[model samples]
Target: MYCVSCRNIHMFFPPFSHLTIVSLLFRCPWTVMANFKGHALPGSFFLIVGLWWSVKYPLKYFHRKGKSSQLTHYYQRLEITEAAIRTLFSVIGVLAEQFVPDGPHLHLSQESHWVKLMNWQHSTMYLFFAASGVADMLTYLSAHTPVGLDRLVMAVAVFNEGFLFYYHVHNRPPLDQHIHSLLLYAVFGGALSIALEVILRDNIVLELFRTSLAILQGTWFWQIGFVLFPPFGGPEWDQSDHNNIMFITMCFSWHYLAALCTVAISYSLVHCFLTRVKRHGEREIIGIQKLKSDHTYQTALLGGSDED
Candidate 1:
């Protein structure tokens, strides 16, 4: 008979088992291995996209000589290449789901109800992935893009991620539940940021909050992999009642460090790219200066022409 508790233990405590090293390395099935891949894949997608968006505005602001509002008004305008990369990642995630053992299949009715529910849970994430991918592609194609649609799609994706994260937290063992719980809140915060952006229409702070949460989630995925599936045989924190406060604080600290590092790296790379493109740099600077000069000339003419 299959034992659910035994399966959960095996899933979380693979190293603690009394298996030979060779067996541990080779005998673990793909079903077991795919869990890490599942998290890591989406984690990478969010990390890259978040890193780009987090740096995009700051780079533009700097390029325009500290005139932040001189560029395009809306923030949803992303480079076509970057948007395509995000879409590609989402597509890959959707395709990757097909290979997972418990993932959704063509024949749903044949499966047990419990199996069906599990499959739905797994498939839901990728469905949202596909939705996000299409939305991004649409953004790339549209000349006159609507900010509301972009915000709505982002809101949907964030909400879906938040729901799945909460579900995982609820099912996690007590030892690991707190970390997942924090992650759930982070996801919600990202969703809230998106929602606020939808209402406020072009706020840098909201966009930063969303991107920050995405990076945090990406970093936490690696942390979960390390904590649950250690390199050697056994998890780092094996006991259910181990000291939780210190670890949680450490996780938060790691997130802060990761965010700072990601932003710095992204900013440096963006600045370098902008500097290398001579025509792009010259055109932006000239355009902003011309606009400023024209505004000044118009103001002087109006003041001089007016009869006091």
Candidate 2:
């Protein structure tokens, strides 16, 4: 409820500064490693295979079925979700911005005027999420069994992602939509925590390297859990194949790493576009709408009314 200005700048922080102290707890190195080892491999593979399946087939299916609007509508939903999350994090960023200038745990401010320049970056990111969600749905349908209780569960999960995408694409994307709103964020934030741990010290790479091995082990555990444990039925892997575990484990690790990198790179592109589009002409062009408006003016071409 209170606003303060310092040196020609105005900022807002939550009344409960004590609440934000929890973010400090995230600074611990071992905790980050635990998180990385938890999902680095399994989460990564599941995400990639999921994405690939989504892209390769469902897109065509949707297009053929004339459900492109469903796709667009889903993207719109994701946009709204992004807007909401952006506002929440923007508030948090405003509160934490003052702390970034001092050390290893840097902060990014959402309240800065320059931050508004990131709008296109945010919008494009929403588009990616919407697109990815559609792909996920397609993959879910194409890869998983389409008949049974397990099928229902996968459908629900895929639908949930689709719903989020719908919300995001409609609302004019805000910055935090994809990362903070989904479980995928947990996977990413965990991996990033590991990256930061490495950056914090000269000898940290070995620790990170070791963490990757642990991740591979954990990924195998996840595959076994999902495969052998339930209504979904055990994996079709032949019990007689001696190298199944080893082969699956390596492939899983590769896919997992690839998924993480893909999402990270996707976001990086979002940031890059944001940086380039920050200004009107010098590399960050913003006047296309103006040019569009001018073309609407009554001209010597084709008689006069706005009814072209």
Candidate 3:
């Protein structure tokens, strides 16, 4: 299926003028209600499972006792991902201009405002909260659950997996590389949401509340992701058979695709840096091994090739 982005970029998408007309015909109460139910059921299910895992298993894998070096390493990883997300959101907020309509109809395309920046920030922040919440739940479940229940975890792993699938299909990344992009996107999204709330003139609790609402609303993008490219081993159901296809097809997915793409680019840069460091370490190890082998060979030569 052609993406809204593909349509918009190619100038094939209908103008915003048709939105009202489409809203009356295609976005009626029945469709709206169906979409809501689609969102509500999966959302509530995830919430319940997340709460259960969080409460049932409170141990944090990120924390290490009596290992300052390990703690430092973990902190470094955290800081790197944090920076990646921030930069990702910043770039995304900047590029948001390109996707917006340039026609005389849309005001957002004309100029960047503090308010728009705040909204973009908030969107990222909310995405972060949701992703962190998922990670928290996954970590807890991994710690507490039996190996046999991996199936269930895989079932719900749909949320993250769906995001990855969408990333590849939308961005056209290789399958092996898509996970890295998704992980970075997830981190950037979470950070952006927090940045939004913190940057705005809102209380901490109010900001969190707002971020939560955004998380809930934005998760529909995942559902839409699931619909657009149903993953391998997914439950038996056709995308067209789903009732909320319009919600999946329309502006919501397009907005998220941009956000995810923004996050992915930032992640790629940051991850490249991290990978280079890792490669340097590996190369050092290989150099040491080669030196040791050369020493052994020289010793054998000094002894006239072989004792025999």
Candidate 4:
């Protein structure tokens, strides 16, 4: 319940502060590499994809009567691009999970040393997403399945990610366990939403809800990086502190609220913007009562009068 001012004169104009943001991204310090940056890479991926769904779904839903919101060729291209990005990022995730010098004992019980099972778990999680992307790409073939194969594939991927993380936190710090558990809520929620999309087929409300969950996961990932591994090499969190654990839970609830608000605002803005411009061959759909009113403008052209 405290508000702290980040207000500073130098920061206002010159881009002050350690650029902890930039350092969090680019610096090569060991903690930044293994902890913050690792979390952030996928965080960026989810955030961008969420924004894509948030924007595209609304445009499609609010299309004008005379035309589709997006042309066939363009929409197909966008789908291809989305799948490609997902696959490429997932591949990168696998690499990052395994290739580090001290990571992922990629062999089976190699003389009972360097088991590093967690590393392999993460790599396998990344592979699931890569599979989801491949399934999405197959849509270009116009292959018909009884349901949305891409959606179901993505749902499986989300479920797999959650499944891994749920077990990944065993014997870890209280703070780490609590934060990651919060993340599972979004992960499983998104998984269920995607599954429902496969069943419901083009339900806009579910689409928007899925988008919100995605953004929540993305933001939560970044927040996790910051909470467990403070930027600019700031002091580490007291993992055992009860108050710290309590605050993290509250912070997560706020993040959920923020994610919902983000989608709501984005939807509202797109609606307002789309309403202003009339599409080609667009005709107004007005009520019959309004059409009978001589004071109405479109009615005058149709020769309707109050008495008529």
TM-score to true structure, per model: 0.68, 0.24, 0.24, 0.76
The stretch of ten residues in a row with the least summed lDDT in candidate 2 is 1-10
* Per-residue alpha-carbon lDDT of candidate 3 for residues 231-305, written as tens digits (9 for 90 to 100): 332553333343433433454545445534433453355455555876898899999999999999999898985
Residue 146 error, candidate 1, Å = 4.0
The ten-residue window of minimal lDDT in model 4 covers 1-10
Clash numbers, per candidate: 0, 22, 10, 0
Ranking by lDDT: 4, 1, 3, 2
Leading candidate by TM-score? 4
RMSD of each: 9.7, 25.2, 17.8, 12.3
Tens-digit lDDT string for candidate 4 (101-162): 65663663576665557667868888999999988888764657435998999999999989
Model with the higher lDDT, candidate 2 or 4 = 4
Off by over 4 Å in 2: 1-222, 234-240, 281-308
Per-candidate Cα lDDT values, in order, are 0.66, 0.38, 0.40, 0.80
- If ranked by TM-score, best first, what sequence of candidates would result? 4, 1, 3, 2
The candidate maximizing lDDT is: 4
Q: State in Å the error of residue 103, model 3.
A: 8.1
User: What TM-score does structure 2 among the candidates reach?
Assistant: 0.24
Error of 2 at 247 (Å): 1.8
TM-score of 1: 0.68
Clashing pairs in 1: none
